[model samples]
Target: MLTSIKSFFSNELFNTEKGSTADSSEHQLQLACAALLIEVAVIDQEFDTRELQALITILQTKFNLSAEECETLRTLAQSESEDSTSMYQFTQLVNSACSPEQKFELIKGMWTIAYADGDLDKYEEYIVRKVSELIYVSHSEFIRAKLAARP
Candidate 1:
């Protein structure tokens, strides 16, 4: 799995440029964010079509990615989320790479996915809450994000 992730980063996600640490970091950030979103979508064990679509839309819009790039990232993230033991790895990358506002936005995206099917599953909400806490989003801000993303 580690080798697959490394190959993904090296071959599929970004073009290799000499000394391009920024690009590598950016791709890692993208993968981390996508994995979190995927986690929310699948936490209920349903993986609803609406949730998948919402996740794709959020990834494309937030990352400014082309459709193909978004799909590739989504596939990789889904695999990572399923194979993972905890959320800490993804959240750690996010905490290191994202600003406070960016973290809040990610919470909003999670809420969006949670509400995508027009029902808020407890497990979905719990995962979102866990991620918010891991990312150091205040309780108030987490509530604000949920309210704002409520459709």
Candidate 2:
């Protein structure tokens, strides 16, 4: 039993390490952004299947990662997103690394996650909007993304 438990944790930690190292700093910034989107999805204790699927799709498409790689990164992002209490760490990484255009794209991705389940809750929207502003996306661009992602 002890061995099983240890192995479980070992596997989890290994996945985490592998996920973090699998991408370059730029890709990691994008990964962190995606993780934040998932973080908000679970904020209300309603992690729907659709949202998860949409997140995986976006990661696969946007990052040009293989399905297996996307799954690994999604798993790692979910872990990191849940463990974090503040957005400081993620925002700091993105603000320092992402260009203005990339920041706009990131906002769009966040909106995509929020709309994944075809239901946008208030808190989720608020979190994404706040994150967009923090990441330096213009209000107009943020609104455009929000509208575009709506069903």
Candidate 3:
């Protein structure tokens, strides 16, 4: 699965810019974002269908991915999130690659997933809060994102 993910990132996603550092960075950024979303979705120990749909929508809209691409990303991100020791690995990449606005949007996406099932678990909120802090999103922005994403 890891090899396939690497192949997809290297070949399908950034084939146009192969061998470039920027391509590598972009691939990492995409994976990181997807992994973070997966993290939030699974934090409550139940990956709801609603959360899966919300995650797919976020990846498709935020990364401009097609359905197939989104599926591939979600699979890879699930694997990555499961094997990962902590959220910092994902959040660090986001902090370095994304702008403040992008980071805010990411927090909102996390919130969206948390609320997708019509219930927000405490662990889910904690994971989102931790990611927001790691990515340097202000406390006010975090609250704002939560409010904006509440459905």
Candidate 4:
């Protein structure tokens, strides 16, 4: 288990040049982002239909994934997130591979998922805050993400 987890976080597997896509590194980064989003969706211990929809919508809008791709990514993310010990590894991958704009969009996606059920559970918000910090998102950017996602 740890080996697979370690491989997932291995720098060689995730060292994608920023702005490069359509490669293994991009795929790995996608998986990491998907996992973090799923973590937020389920943090409240009640994964509502609205939250699920929000997750799918966010992935589709942000990554332009087809339904089948979204399903596969979500399934992989769910399994990985269940086995993962911490968010740091995933955020580390994002920080290394993504541009600042990409990171901000992810934080905004997280906030959207957190608010999808119409109330932000304390734990959900905490996860978003922690992820923001881990991904090196500025406090101002974090606040902007939250405000941008506010409905």
TM-score for all models, in order of appearance = 0.94, 0.80, 0.93, 0.85
Q: Candidate 1: misplaced stretches above 4 Å?
A: none
The alpha-carbon lDDT assigned to residue 138 of candidate 4 equals 98
RMSD to native for every prediction?
1.3, 5.5, 1.6, 5.3
lDDT of 1 by residue, 1-151 (tens): 8667666777766656634678778877888999999999988889899998999999989999888888999999988888888888899999999999999999999999999999999999999999999999999999999999999
Q: lDDT scores for all predictions?
A: 0.91, 0.73, 0.90, 0.86
- Which regions in candidate 3 have their CA more than 4 angstroms from the true location? 1-4
Candidate 2, residue 97: Cα displacement in angstroms equals 1.3
Mind giving the per-residue lDDT tens digits that candidate 2 earns over 73-123?
A: 677677778777788888888899878877777778778878887888898
**Model 4, residue pairs in steric clash:** none
Supply the global lDDT for candidate 2: 0.73
State the lDDT at 131 in candidate 3: 93
Q: TM-score order of candidates, best first?
A: 1, 3, 4, 2
- What's the distance in Å from true for residue 91, model 3? 1.1
Model 3 lDDT per residue over 63-98, tens place = 898899899889888999999888888888998889
